[model samples]
Target: MLSISSTRQRQPFTVLILICLLLLLPTSLPFLLPPPTTRPSLPTLRSPPRRSPPLPPSSSSSSSSTSLSSSPLDPLLSLSTLASVILIHELGHYLAARTLNIKVSEFSIGFGPKLFSFTRSIINNKMNGEEENIEYSLRVLPIGGYVKFPENYNSSLVMEEELKGREKFKEKLNVEKNEKGILGMFEWLNEEEEGVVKKKVKSGSKPKITTPPKEIEYYTDPNLLQNRRPRDRFIVLSAGVVFNFLLAFILYFGSVLFGPGLLKTEINRGVLVTSEPIPYSPSSGILHKGDVISSFNGVNLLKLPSDVNVIEKEISEIIKTIKSTETGNEIEIGRGSERITIKPSLAVGRSYPTIGVSLSPNFSGVSKIKTRNVFEAVKLSVQEVCKVTKSTTKGLASFFESILPKFGGGGGGGGGSISGPIGVIKLGSDVIGQKDWSALINFAAAISINLGVVNALPLPSLDGGQLGFVVLEKVRREKIEQRTMDDVNAIALFGILILSVGTVFSDTMRLFGK
Candidate 1:
């Protein structure tokens, strides 16, 4: 009956193997057999345009450009990339625990219902009758993941018992030696003394006593995380944050080193003339498309403040100057290599001065921006990561500030806005629609840095919260009550659930334009 049951289990394994083989067979057929004769090509069919023609470049092209650049896999690719980073973050904790000889029970990616799972024995000792297994799993959702260690690792008493047992073994060896005669004592001293004493003894004397070396057995408790030094525990808890920051740095550095392109805006290059001049307006034919305004009136647009903010201020000043002047202003524009001067005529209707041609705020262009060496890339990448971190920190602070009042006594009419999973997906889709590789990479890096920062916030049910507990334990020199910790975590979990649901609701409303 046992054999039959075992065979029944093996049948499923056999079937699985056969299915896998069959699936692989077609893929391997090309290599296994000679190339087949070429088949006749089918007639190609072309699909008609699904949308209207794009507007002229002079008008805002954001919508049309996005439509043209978008790819079907953008959302899926972004989600997968995010999942990969989250997995790395979990791996950091898993590795740290394993390095300290703490047994991790499970390492799982994603949350909720498990889609697939497998277990492997990391350590097995038949003689000692000891085995340690780790289960790895994948789940249906890709929001977050975790690495679980043994729940009860407080093994100080077990260590004490082991020490006492070793001492008892030594005492037993000593007692056994005493039970023997003087010959046994001599044998215990050295092998040479035992042999000499045996030769000295008369024939047929009591057999020389022999005492074998005591076998000192050793055992290791796999559940060591709780019993480990506070420093180790702290490191294990903080490893996830460290790995997340590392991932951000790597992504930023790689993007700068080998990015597809970068968006750049050169100052004093003059605004781009986007359209042909309108008739019955000043400088209708004089200033045409592609003209770069080097100087407006007497002010040189090329020579403005060096600081970015100050430069923007100066540009605003130029616009104000033009609007204030009722008469036409002499504008020196750079057209190719030639510098042409034209005066924009005053508009017939009341308001500001008029220039017939449409002008872009800035002539921004995309250019490759790779570093010459890795060191330079690393330096720049670090700066970029720092900048993004600061911005995200500020944004989160603002978000909390806006939302906190709603739950408090002071009622605010406008509640704070936050992007949930759905919102994030929409935002990611828009970014991917830009079809700029540098933009995509930069966005990913920013998200990674934000994830790191969020995990490091001192809130319950987070890595930082775990670190906070470790710090308290270190300061108090006492283990916090397990029940209290569990209760606190449960409350945190509940709070998170409420927040997630609210965010999801908000995201749904925003998605459906409600």
Candidate 2:
């Protein structure tokens, strides 16, 4: 019976391992396959466009090109990037606690059983003859990390005991009146106390309490997280969110400054028409090559004349609206310097209208917008981060609103609406396969921003939840009972478990095309 129970417990981990193996193995196939003998020729019919001769490859360029061509199934790079970002977030909390003189008992990356661990002694004068050892560990699972602190009541009791012992020693030495003075003013000590102090001073012994019974310092002796001021605790709680946001902003800045050329338009031109009209198509006579499309169905193509922001989004919306319609639509084009309006009729038996003209694949007449200086990049990055944050917040709210109703209805049609770990891995694999640094970097930045925003939410089991408890304690001017805190934490854990299970189920359904 026990064996059966243990096997059941291990099944989820076994399945997870299998899933990871399946997801990663296919990506490595390209590495095993032979390299191409020569560059593949482009498809004919249009007569492939002319290209510039290849430049000589330097060492750095060669390595980068190789990386670009590497198999998309290689999960190492993406996984490592994610792990590093999470580690930095946790480090923010650790650093803040250490800065505030609060003792952190353990610092660990990941969850579950410890895979490896090491201890480091922290020697400080405030430790009161106690040795402070911090244990750093890496755990089996890489989902998240934590910094553990001594229990508040235990730490307070130990500190009170230590203070009592110090007071007793002062009484024994008859130097209670000298408490206000520096240690060097030992003149108030009686002969016996003076002799004892001299012998100890000569021996370079640590400060001792001679009156009370001797006691060994325990784990609770050091000043702990709860002993810090409220503001300091708040900082410690919020530092992870701050670090995640900082990482996201840095990634955004890098993607803009160093990524592929940003899509833009020429000063007075729109998207230049490139392809000749298709035969018997809606645009056969009305549309022609070299016509720049400036608007579609009464909507202007450019939201901002000079800025490239929203260009892709507007274009996508326009295409979606056009494809959804079953009738003709108006298109405004720039021919030379003249603006002309044309009505494109729907092709026979097709649902959407067709102009039959193709946009320039190379963006021939359009401009590539690149940051000219670091200041502009920084400013743009900030704006991008703010925009992402707002959009993510709204999305999360909508997701919750949609899912909460399904919980009671027993419905199962949200498979495509949300993503879990499996979905994320699949998406990451796709991005990696594309071998585009800009896309990968932008994806990473989005994930980082999501992490920051999600963690900032006032939900139980999250950093913001901890901050909420701190705020409650401050308001009540009393510590919450340990039992109550435990109950809250347990409830939070259970809620997370339910959410995770549902999300994983949804992801699986999507994976199987349900």
List residue ranges in candidate 1 displaced over 4 A.
1-69, 112-115, 124-130, 140-144, 153-223, 261-368, 411-417
CA shift at 187, candidate 2, in angstroms? 64
Q: What lDDT score is found at residue 210 in candidate 1? A: 42
Worst 10 residues of 1 by lDDT: 29-38
Model 2 is weakest, by summed lDDT over 10 consecutive residues, at: 29-38
- For each candidate in the order shown, give its overall lDDT on alpha carbons: 0.55, 0.55
lDDT of 2 by residue, 218-276 (tens): 33433666556668778988888898889878876775577542322233324445567
lDDT at 254 for candidate 2? 71
Q: TM-score of the candidate numbered 2? A: 0.55
- What would the C-alpha RMSD of candidate 1 be, to one decimal place? 23.8
Best by TM-score: 2
Candidate 1, pairs of clashing residues: 282-345
For model 1, residues 1-514, the per-residue Cα lDDT tens digits are 0000111111111111122222322111000000000001111111111222232232322445222366898777766655576677777888888777777777776666799999998554432445778888887665446676665523344446556777765776577568875445455545776687666664546544344423323233534565567899888888887887888788767766765422222323444465678886666767766556656555565555433334434455555555555564565555544677666566667455656665543333233356758899888778766766665665566556656877795432222235554555556666666665555666566666666777677765667776788899999999785445555755764565455555555656877886
Error of 2 at 98 (Å): 1.3
